[model samples]
Target chain A: MRDPVTTVRPAAWPKTPALKVGPADDACNVLIVGVGGQGVIMVSKVLALLAQSQGFEVKQSEVHGMAKRGGSVFSHVRFGKRVWSPTIPKGDVDILVALEWAEGLRWLPFLKAGSGIFICDTKRIVPPFACLNRKPGAPMRYSKETPAEVVAHVGEAYAIDATDMAEQLGNERAANVVLLGALSTALDFSSTDWERTVAEFVPKKTIPVNLEAFRRGRGWIEDARTSTPAVDVPAPTPATAAPYRIRLDINPAWCKSCDICVKMCPERCLILNAERIAELAAPDKCTGCRLCEWLCPDFAIRVNLDAPEALAR
Target chain B: MYIETAADFDVTDYLRKEMMPHFLCPGCGHGIALRALLWAIHDLGLDRDKLAVVSGIGCAGRLSAYIDANTFHVTHGRPLAYATGLALARPDLHVVVITGDGDCLAIGGNHLIHACRRNLKLTCLMLNNEVYGMTGGQVSPTTSETRLTTTTPLGNQEPHFDACALATAAGAGFVGREVTHHVPKLKELIKAGLEHPGFAFVEVLSDCTEIFGRKNDMGSSSDMMMRQKSEIRPSAYLDTVDTPFRSNALPTGVLTRNDRPEYGAAYRQAASARAGTSS
Candidate 1:
């Protein structure tokens, strides 16, 4: 299998001819698919709101199966002069926004052949259950197919590293907005309308960062249209990485003893101390993936990239 | 105490008049549960100022909005935890929690068990409609075997939870069960629960007519009520059987009672003893 984290910039963008701005009588069906907590619902809400602003009747139907546990979730959004049903018929979806690579493949049957625009984020979330029966010392099971395979199957597909782009913009949770930015390029909507819809839908505090992420997504697509390949930086390796130790600082006054960060840390580097504030428990094991920092709702924990011990390392 | 006859029970004093008409469906049993709760408070003549109602998110949770008391509509499945804190901090106030089957038995099950074990002075009324009514009738923990729900398009294969048995096992000071069809009996159970000194748990078997009822072909609201009337058995009769709840006969009435030391009073006594103060 190909490297899962490798950025798969679309070789060419705007593959389809410019969409004809048909009258309100012509309806459009958009399908969004992702695992729970990836903000698939938020993207659909923005689309519905933008459709409504354009004086179109919008109907959105969402299937939330065991949400909050990384279960499969999808939404059907139909917008037109008159929306009769909340669900879009099979093989009638015009635009498909998949927040996960495999999920995009899962909904390939729903997309309109030759005409559908498939926008996917090249982030592979390996299903936990997929590894239940694996043998010890076996390779970790992930999506064997590449984004190129997905593009070939869908006929007209754009694969972008939305998660990496959002992380570059300071917050990884803004990946949905990045995909929305890429989606905005395929549609015949103005940037002003997309910005207004995003500002109205996203929280007030996250408006600035999310807007920047959105613009970066649009810019990526615009650059791809000119055959500009996305920057191909080699994946970070522990040896070649910045010779710095991961340092975590916890603001005790800000922490409410939630312990979310401690529980979410994949490296088991954090633990709640006697005072219930998060403290670095196993600093040597710290990989500095920033999962704890991103998952911390209180923003009480800060992971400093460069420590003074870097010179010694 | 002034209410002499059923017809004379004035519920307007207990309700938020501005919030009416309530948003319940035509035959929803939540209204019945709310009425019984109001009647219990009315009969006890408890000061409304000292009464606080806490609820999680569901159709039953909406009971907080309609009641003209200190009501807290908290997040889904955490009402019991919230009520535990309220009961401990302000021992003078009576904290009653209203929750649905999905809220109490599924997401909030851990809190429910812990609260029962703590034996805090709180009344928790669990309205079990066997389906999640607010979210369009998804299969809940209390949904009976072979029942139809939106999620369980086919019949539910899982065995249902016996909430009363669960509470009794969890060490609640008081445990009662009643159906919405028996309003007078339900009111009595609610009143008894309110008067109990420690963690009082009352499970009211209600119906979701629009969702569960319609899906199961259990005709209209009145039809479902008739089914409830026939299915329920007295607590005294239920005790004789080895498997009391193995069949369709649901036991209704106070199943257990004890004099466990309430958490708030016990904590205060322990703290005072540590400080060399007389209790």
Candidate 2:
């Protein structure tokens, strides 16, 4: 594996200036490759929707090959002054966004030689066939490879730990949005444009965290660009400050006792009581992060950081 | 056997004559089901102006386009919701909804259950060809585990939904299932469903000869019709079998019929009662 320190190389930016206007002959072709259920379709949809909102003609096609069963899925998105075809011709893709490292390697042939930008999620899911023990006279064809190795083959690829970043932001599913954020930096789109599209596409409850994930991704790229050469760039750790004391109060009447708050607590600080309502099991472990509050479908649970007892503590 | 000809069975009065030459592929059972529906409407002697047919997007959904009536071709999996509104507003109109397996059981599942629970006065005819024919034969909710589709290359491991059983359990006042091969019986069921006061759900086991049939090795259109004729047993035979579906015996008749209070009539009654109490 290449050094984690060198993974964030400084001179990896595109040589050509990012195109602002969609030229007739030079439509940008983006190929998003990932395993099924990785939200690759949603990412392409958001891209197409955003492009259409900006007065560009967009054509998108998705191939769902055994998508629900952890098989390969990809979408081709072409946008320009006038997009004629839904598919991008082979070897003409401008940007290749792979949600998995192996998928990046698998679809590398689609990228244009020497000029294409490869952005890959550093998450690797071992396919089922790869993990099965080999039988006599029959060998397994699957092998594991690092993101660094994939980046090496692609000549210049950006490897971002999008899943880890999304988990840090309290939802792993927002990794797709995080990749979209990194994509926004490579393209000539503004944050306001992305924000508006995110609001329009993402669910109303998830808008805040998804937008935060997008900004974090954009900021990560910005930091890599401005930093001095050879300086080791560490992953951005969002501020996680826990109050000295906190209390969780669940309104028993409102609580249908779905056990969502009890199950979703990262610290295991909440529990279901005999009445099947949520009860604070360990107040000291409560971080006041409000994950329970956000996850609770019913607005029954409340995190009280400013209780008199908490203040006294 | 009765030899019927086009001249004797002229449904020209109920068809959009100009829209003909229809778009359904040869050997498609959707056409058969459409003919059955048209025959049911003609048999009932229903006024053409008072009937409204709604359909969602699919090969089966295209039935609304060909029928010469007040038809609304809504988005995929949403015909039931639209028909519900039309039925409520104009209770005099007989609103019928046509949908495919994927459109009704997969995407429109919530609306289906709610419509049944409410016992709305609407006839929902779900055509189960066992594949999503319009999208080039993707495996749908009704596609059996023994079958294969583009998405299920290795064979479908997912359990299929029993649409008739689901509708029965969801509180539909009338529930029936029939194969397109049994056109006479299918038409009778549709006619009975149209007369039912509450939610009437009929599942038609249609054939997709081009996509589903070719993939499953179910030979020509005639072969499929023979299979349907031999496979389906009477409703009484279902009780004697352990697993009717596994035994290759599907009951082709009215499965359930109840007399639930229709939603529109109940709503109006409640509203008038409330008004009386306030006065």
Candidate 3:
């Protein structure tokens, strides 16, 4: 709800931060990782604005061109006395905020080893690419690490159900704002300043809901900092798909020797017999996509993808 | 639009069952195109009695007789002319005109343009076989340049007419082009045209395997169909998605669509405003 035009932050920036930049380092690098449309860039904008207002030069760079279609989206916000490179070096990210669970695992190597603060949402967004396996019982290609394991690996980590909390607040889209609220705790910014900046970024009507979401997220993180983070129930095992058989009925009496079924078949398993009638020569090669039946001008071809288990008498 | 599972759509349900082994030649793409039109009608859940399919004289014209619903087999190149009057008279009827390339673009060229100009609520499906198959294989307006028809023995020298482009230029509200090889895609295109409120002109690239293919040594019915499919590109994937279309590929799908005022609705509004009496 910022500018609704600029890909980067269009909201008013906060005034100051706690000045937590290490003496050995020149800037504080916070990496916000999430799938596109999760408001990763928006969170980075808030951070950049707060740092800039604190008299520290802020350099924010992001990659979100493919974010609109559920693609990987990440933004780097570095603020200090004078920032140079817009990108954070690998293993140098002071804090890593992940809007999605799998993406947090994917970008784990970038977090500063043994010291980086890891705040991740327990929301699982199985991408379209993960469902490519067509086998009956094949498992999806996704991260297998659980919250317990991920928390144990990182020096300090908090896996919160920010999405569910936002949904309970009556806006699933505010999930990103919730993640932002959790991120605000990792920085030195004041609570009131963070809330005011979030209010500016979000729509006027949803200000009340987002403010409550921010408080809930801030509370969840604070509780987890003192105790163990709660683990979510693992993803349900993929169900075995129905086993279907491709059955083709080609009526020779009606076939006009058009050779359409034989030639247009995607598998090229169809052939003309001695009488030049269409026949399923290699039945095993047919996938039952029904290209033969649909293209047959003579209406001599009929295909059925029947459940093999149901057909057993 | 949602794609219906093929299991739900049966071509025989909409067809006069006895008409099986239709007179169309082996591998004639018209049958496939006909199946798409019927599938669209079936998917739309249109009432059989409320549908009026009108056709002109050609291979495409014979399609009207096979439909189980009401149909009109009119004279050559006059299906659109007849459809305009029929649509105005009975706005409730889903008037669809089925005509071949020769029947639509050549003989009934004037009617085609005027139909576009009027922007009536009609779905005019022009099946472009590129030849007059029913008339013993002659050159048609959509016939590609340097193609062999009985009339063009030495490969046609005239450039083929882009039917969808013509309809678009003539001010048709909705215009689309699709191939018969992809039956489901063709059905989806036809369905979109049917759903349009104003004049919808769909040019289906069909094959006359027996006549056009044999005369041009175009291998077999499947070969001709595949060739046409390979040469033309689906309109939906021209941008963003990777496409098989090369430089010479003819784009398909709904090419032109606009919010032109439909003749029937405007006519009714005017008549009611003036007559001020119930019909």
Candidate 4:
């Protein structure tokens, strides 16, 4: 590890990495870096939302930098004990995912020591000015560039032309999903179940092509591992590992006669009385997702995850 | 086969199936304006199938696709005209017109005034992003005098039109102006507009990230959103301000609300008279 004083310490850590079967911890940080409108943020959100669905404390930040002009964009995502910041600072990122090769170097500063596993695309986006300068302003310019030579100084790297695979899948938009697949192969996360997360992020219509891209991406990581050393990052820690109960509480003063809560409850657990006051019909059906709390206009309803039965009464 | 989870609300679904002529520049205020309108629909528990969203040809007009209800992407500056026909034809449907500054006050200005004058039972959301963003930042009727657009290199020589004041004067039953960034308040105003029985006009102050966003050095779409929170005063106090027509004056709410005779009621009366004469 680097000097503790220099390193940006995480706000909190789980007691253990629950996903790992051995002495290794089940935790790793993955940074999704790419140009805007290329689906960098979408990839990160899909992963974070998937992790969240699996009961993992996933913290994904909002998209940063100029996303409109295909400029650089990144989403720092870490899942463990309630992630706050999206950035990993410098030399702390476990996986450096570059949708484009130039972006790989731009974000290489965040790679961890002896642990910088670069899962990057060999594609290159030569911007408008580069074309004027007579530079090789072309897409997929790194299709032949030696991935090993590029990252020889930093650490180990795995480069894949995920764009070609995505194109073969029929749509170029699947390029990011392919990268996610490669990531799942390198990490201990279930690549098989990754589709569930991908589906959650994209609209239902775009799921099939995205699934194919994800499969291709995962296959690239698995195939590349035969020629390279496997990444030794820890497995993910699930958020629901610890047993916790939930209960519902309502503040009568903030209640509006809108009946939003009664309509919002999926289980028909809430009922509006003759006077329009909402009361519990079947409080036991509450899953405590806090969707009701977030949806309530008056902010009258709350979910007590800590004191479940106490608040329910 | 079955995908089960929460954290719903996807924008692409709106983009793919619904939103056509998708030219509402990325991060534009039109998206927020549309979102507020949809939130109003959701909050009011309005029947999705019974709702009809009509729009004119501008950034705001693209909203017909974003809403998951019956939508009509009418010709430029003709949303109110189409909406009037639709509302009168299908009185059970909740018709909403999403128009822009240029679409409403310039090309469709006559339609808007007449719609309010006739007290048509419709909710009109005129998004005032100041300039005509789709047509390469041209000067619009709602454009501030000193603002620089593509056509107005130095400054606009033409005066701006106060939409809320004009609608209130035109005998609209309900008229309100809200900045797009004030999402909660905007949602409430739109919900109230839908609930009203007659012509309800809501002027939403929005931003054009592509044209007006850069010319005025308004920063990126995200930075321009800060003005909504900073500049707009609380509705409770601002609505009480007299001389609401002054420039830079905070937007007011419910400018005019008088129970007037509706156009549909008059039409029905005329139809009954004609039926009796024929008999």
Candidate 5:
């Protein structure tokens, strides 16, 4: 386990960036991102409603068709005195709130060059598209950039574990609301207004928990803003020094010529010989996961991870 | 508290040495299921003498003969009936009845229901292979619809029985189902079933590779195992509705569980109370 990156944000706010956008007539582009069913739209809806309550024209556009089955669902909420487009232009988002860690990286280019504040949950939701490498111990194609690296790239980044915090609060579904609370600190919205707006969107019974979640999320950012530093380089991951030497002791006496280990071997390392007995056709490819040893009905395959003859196949 | 790892579990240690290379067809999933059962027994640290493996006549029944424990290979469809009596007489022994689809559901249907109702402290593992393998691959009650067996030349028209559901409906204290593809998980489920206080019915969806696979064109044993793994992703222990594997497939895992009183102790308590009144 690596040490957490200490967050050392500036003590003073930079004139409240969204409030410096000239007037309420200028649209404040807010993009909320997460997987389907993570309440991405709900966060955007709460924001849109809050802006609309303040008498601003809000055009909230989202694609939630993939939400039912858990795809990358995003909502673009641009509100101003006279909002024209429902979507925000590329690289013009004032604030980007990501409920999932990987998704935050996916939409990093859309953030404003220097002043954009990124409030993101550090919970990694690796999409199914990234799960292409099924080989044992294969490094997954996820974002390798650490929180500190991402924080360095943006003007302000808060990598909070909102989902974990909400889970501890007995309602994991309130994670979006927690992120919204964090986002509230970025915008010039009242805590009471954020709570009331989030309360209106969630169920009547879950108001108290969601409100508490919002408070916790808001307090976390506040604590980070004053207390600590966040530029700690993440400790390097320990590389696999030496793979376990795998050896297959195929007891030919018990092998039933079933071809189970031959077919089911993910590495295709095992093959049926001319005698119809399973043999290690490719020793280099074996990872010693023991799929063959467990699936062998005849008790013919015995995988010795640390074989007696360590070097010999 | 006794933690046992799979590396320490030697299947040969629990098997009768004389019964080496047992008489099951090649690529049969029963052998995998047998390994899981033995592994579970090993994990529980149960004494060989204290364990009773009773089985009805079928390929699964033949499994009891290979076990290096107190085994009873009873007549077809009577293993549950016999196990119910043995468990009541000797409550100290851990009784595990291994029955197949035809042996348990079609012929011994009443026995299974009554056994569940009795809630005896027994672990009944029904290895549903969808066909009677020993008797020339005949159609069984748990056979999937349109699966080709020797008896179902045109295809099986009858709806299959979800054994776990049936046991749960009959009020068995613990009901679960798992496939042979996930051997370790199957062992864990069996271990849980064994540890349950009251009656536990675990349905192991096995593959009769030689018979079922060839006839149904279900590919090799490896393909069959993959199909078992993919065709039915085991649903959550309690969340049976969020099924994503197949639209119409029955959910697996510990489908239902309750804290019902065990029959053996409950019966003895009631009998002693009545005897006290009579005296």
Candidate 6:
């Protein structure tokens, strides 16, 4: 197995085609669309954070359907000079980053002419209704109108089966990261920015595959840039602020290394010490989502938000 | 020796301290229930400083925002849990919970039943309007069977919950019912509920003129109130008895009033016993 975090090319940001519009022009609006449980909201949040780090005003709103079961989900992410509404009007979206190919078509109405980019994975998830009604499953039919095909037919498109790529990389859910890898080229963001975003958004247990998927996407973008002049976008400056500040801490004395804390750490920051106590592997990577503290069986690993001195020292 | 009438009772004074302006519709049952409770508090002469009101979300949940006393407006259906926590933490305060039927039985029904079973020292008033008035006329758990609502246009199929019966069965020390129009009876029930030593449940059948009236043709407030008095007669057998009965009949007076150690006091006793053993 790959050494999860170490093998990830954190610094491997190969130069791609740069698109620099003057600062006065508004930053383009990108919509990330997917079904519930497919991590569209996480991608939107990371995109929002990424945009903010690049000194752009960002506003985002998520429309979650009946999320417990397989349901249609989408997020409106508007980031530019002055974003008023969190919604992207029809036919105005610049980049549509879809985790699934069918989800890309689900949001096809918002694609603009000439500049619109549809970055998608060829994976298919048949919604429940299509299965129960004996109707032709939306998935089999949807693959034909792939994001790449749609974008190419309308303006520009990049289509890859990110799911197969991530599965080959040994993680299936990292499909979104693989698509994100494809998206980094269109947006002209750095690899460090992608890694930082992944470290913050994707929990620790799945980080390895997610990082690999991102690398795969970034590589695809680099290779594609050689063939076609990449979309005109300026390089995003690295966030100067100590960006990956972690808030959760583990108490070495109390933790029995029960693996519950490690399993529950959404950011995958906690590791086992010699004495079987859960310890922080990447203290800076903790986003303080606090899923670990809520699910801890032993109450060992604490979200040390209450004591500033203990955490700061 | 002097006898004074209720005319001297400043009902608004019993408002659980610094009350806030709220979103209750004019002449809403919740407003009447609040007035009756205040009158009861004044009649019982309870200390204002020792009062704690816990409410859940709904139109009634707005009670927390208004009261001057320590008030907790917890999540819908979770006020009892928060109230349980508060009652345990501060046993000295008179913990009173004001909740709507939908807020209590439908969402918070589990907590309400458990609180009664545990016999915690708290007074719970369930304001039943037969529909979820705040969120539109949705059919609520306490909504009467065959009643029309926004969600149940053809009429509600689900049988309404008898809060008093549920509480009595759950071992609450006191359980009673009264309509909002019967302010005197409502005040009496509220007083008894508050004075009870353990968990007390009082159901106040109220009017939802905007929803129930609009749908069921219950008529104007006065006509509806008059109907409430005429239609709702206290169970005859209960009128004669001084003590409460265990049967789940619709009686006017106190249904069940029995002495039982509250959950918090029992928990503290157990904790102290362990401490004593260790020492």
Q: Write the per-residue lDDT of candidate 2 for residues B1-279, one digit (tens) a residue.
A: 221221233454567867765677656777778877877887777888999999999998888998999999999899999999999889899999999999999999999999999999999999999999999999999998878899999888899999999999999999999987666778789989999999999999888877988999997665676677787786856787576654657777899999999999999888889999999
Worst 10 residues of 6 chain A by lDDT: A1-10
lDDT of 5 at B68: 95
The DockQ of each candidate is 0.01, 0.01, 0.59, 0.01, 0.63, 0.01
Q: CA lDDT of each candidate?
A: 0.80, 0.78, 0.84, 0.71, 0.84, 0.70
Local error of candidate 5 at B14, Å? 1.8
Better of 1 and 2 by lDDT: 1
Per-residue C-alpha lDDT of model 2 across residues A6-85, encoded as one tens digit per residue: 33322322234454454344677889999998889989998999888877788999988556589888999987766778
The Cα RMSD of model 1 versus the native structure comes to: 22.9
Tens-digit per-residue lDDT, A236-257, candidate 6: 2233343324455554544444
Top-TM-score structure, candidate number:
5
For candidate 5, write residues B8-109 as lDDT tens digits. 777888888677788898999999999999999999899999999999999998899999999999999999999999999998899999999899999999
lDDT (10s digit) by residue, model 1, range B1-279:
322434334555677867765677655777778878888998888899999999999999988998999999999999999998898889889899999999999999999999999999999999999999999999999999999999998999999999999999999999999987666778889999999999999999887878999999997665787688788887876668676653668778999899988888989988889889653
Give i-RMS (Å) per prediction. Answer: 21.7, 25.8, 1.0, 15.1, 1.0, 23.8
Candidate 1, residues A54-172, lDDT tens digits: the string is: 77678999988546589889999887666777897788778889998778878988887766778888877778876552322234455666666566566566788999999998899
* lDDT string, candidate 5, A1-313, tens digits: 1213222222222334344434433677889999988999899999999989977678999988777577888999987666778898888888899998888888989887766778888877776666564434555677878887788667777888898889999999999988998888777667888888888999999999999999998888887777664433442333343345666789898899999898888788998899998999998788777889889988888776663456655
Q: How well does chain B match by TM-score in each candidate?
A: 0.94, 0.93, 0.95, 0.87, 0.95, 0.89
Give model 2's docking category.
incorrect
lDDT of 5 at B75: 92
Write one digit per residue (lDDT tens) for candidate 4, span A179-219.
Answer: 99877755545765688878778778989999888887877
Of 2 and 4, the candidate ranking higher by DockQ: 4
Clashes per candidate (backbone, < 3 Å): 0, 0, 4, 4, 5, 10
TM-score of chain A, every prediction, order shown: 0.65, 0.63, 0.77, 0.59, 0.80, 0.60
